[model samples]
Target chain A: MSVQHVKIVKNVLAGNDQTAERNRARFNAAGVLAVNVIAAPGAGKTSLIVKTMAALGARARVGVIEGDIAGSIDTEKVLAAGACDAVQINTGGNCHLEAGMVQRALDDLDLDRLDIVFVENVGNLVCPTHWALGEQLKLCLPSTAEGHDKPIKYPEIFAVSDVIVLNKIDLSELVDFDRDFFYKAVRALNSHAPIFEISCRTGAGLSAWADWLLNQHPHLDTKTERLHHLSGAPGM
Target chain B: MHELSIASYLLESVEAQAQELGAQRVLAINLVAGERAGIVDDALQFSFDLLTPETLAEGAHINVRRTFMRFHCAPCDCEYSPKVGNFSCPDCGAVGQLTADGTELLIESIEIET
Candidate 1:
């Protein structure tokens, strides 16, 4: 028996990362700001999307991509909440949404008509942090009810997230969430991103959240923006 | 579930590399992962076992070595792991940042038989 050793240093996720870059290029071509929303189950991802869409109104053209383990319930809600268009991606049984799956979903959405696309990632903190879907921003939601130590337990997710959304603060009175501990822990993981504390059930802190969304995509304010509604360009 | 996906990528890359070298089958592979890489070794092995059935990498052994998260505390100029779970320097208990030592996931080498 003859054997040989071949040495190669390559990232195991190279294929996925390359595909994500392609997805990002596609989104850029249409001037769509893509946001990947990740969180643990029941972290209020869908509620935030719904509220953001309603708040943006005519301020921005928004599309929704609902990712679930199996079902179209979130898609139905986004459509009802007035998303310019929406795409539903069911992971079947996967714990997370990979770049290839996001690529396939992008084919169905009219990216030219949208300013920002929010991908509601399949609820799982650990798995979703590894995959990138060519998104310009990654939003991570950790409900205060879920406890403050989440940033420590799942540090990788918070470390990579661009925006940390603290949801369900409406129950801060009832729940024993330590605000100082959570911020300090999150700072250990990530120090640059702004942490937004909001209650999706009430409009307590959504104005600032929506304002932050607008700042992410400044093209909405520029007249030079290649808007599908204002221009004759077709969706790529 | 993520391991299964990772194993698929590893197998595909190994098979492609093996074929390029005119090898008929692959025997084993060495994978190096850093402390912050966030992968489970047993889960990766289990997925590799189930995924290599019909590929050129069938029956191949996968060896995963994890490089622990290393940090250097500047406050006391000490180097250690995050003992307190938040970059708390083990030597002097000062907060530090993630070092480059154990943050990468790499496919080191592969063995194949002709």
Candidate 2:
């Protein structure tokens, strides 16, 4: 048998990325800010969602997409937390949430009615970084209890995150979490992402976070236009 | 594991290409992965081995080439390979912006016996 060398170069992630761009267009058309919330399991993701909804109360209409491996528990929690709408995605043992999953969840949500949607990714730090869910912002939540070495170990997430929230700061003293070491590690990888230190239990430092989130919500006309521009629509 | 799913995708791609080219057997696959691509090489290889049995790619060799994350400073017009954690530009001290060099997971070529 003779060996035939057929040259075919292709990206493994191209399919997922195409779907992600489609999801992004849908979000842009609806003028909703989609935030991908990523962290390890039990890092106060649910509590932060609850506190964020409470903090943004009466100002903006918020929705949520909860991604878990098997249960709809977090979806129920967010709904109870007064989210305008919530949809749960069970990954069925997958370690991360891909764009295709989020695309399906968006179909269940009333995109036109909501101003912001938080996509709570499955609780794995490494795998989730590889997939883009068409979000305008990527939020990395690492609790102080998880220790300051998270950035050192998971540099990919820190480098790509738009914002980093150090949750469970109330337990910092108890855990001996070194703030200086954490900041140094994070800054080394990502210089622009704003790091927020907050205790979800006490609601401390949430006002600033809420204010920043509110400011990030794009105006309707500008958002649509900008998205159209980015997507290269026929007319400007 | 996500690697299992990724391996499945890779298999699908290989099968499709093999069918299109009308190749009888797949000898090997050339793959490229970047440091921040979120794929563990050993796990990917294990998944590939698990999934390729009794297929055209069964007993095929998957040769993976790993790449590191590289950054560039726009103002300084220089590109630098970051040392694991630090991404700042060395000379100008400007915040290094990530380029498209790394974070790639691609199937470069396939060797088939016809």
Q: Write down the lDDT of every candidate, Cα atoms only.
A: 0.86, 0.87
- Per-residue lDDT tens digits for candidate 1, residues A89-149, read 9888899999999999998999877889999999999888888889999999999999988
Steric clash pairs (candidate 2) = none
Interface RMSD of each: 1.6, 2.6
Q: Report clashes for each candidate as comma-separated counts.
A: 0, 0
Query: Which candidate has the highest DockQ of all?
Result: 1
Against the true structure, whose lDDT is highest?
2
Model 1, runs deviating above 4 Å: A223-236, B84-86
Q: In model 2, which runs have C-alpha deviations exceeding 4 angstroms?
A: A220-236, B70-101
DockQ-based CAPRI category assigned to the predicted complex of candidate 1: medium
Question: Tens-digit lDDT track for model 2 on B67-107?
Answer: 88777778889888876445568888765666667677999
Residue A2, candidate 1: alpha-carbon lDDT: 97
User: How does chain B score by TM in each prediction?
Assistant: 0.90, 0.86
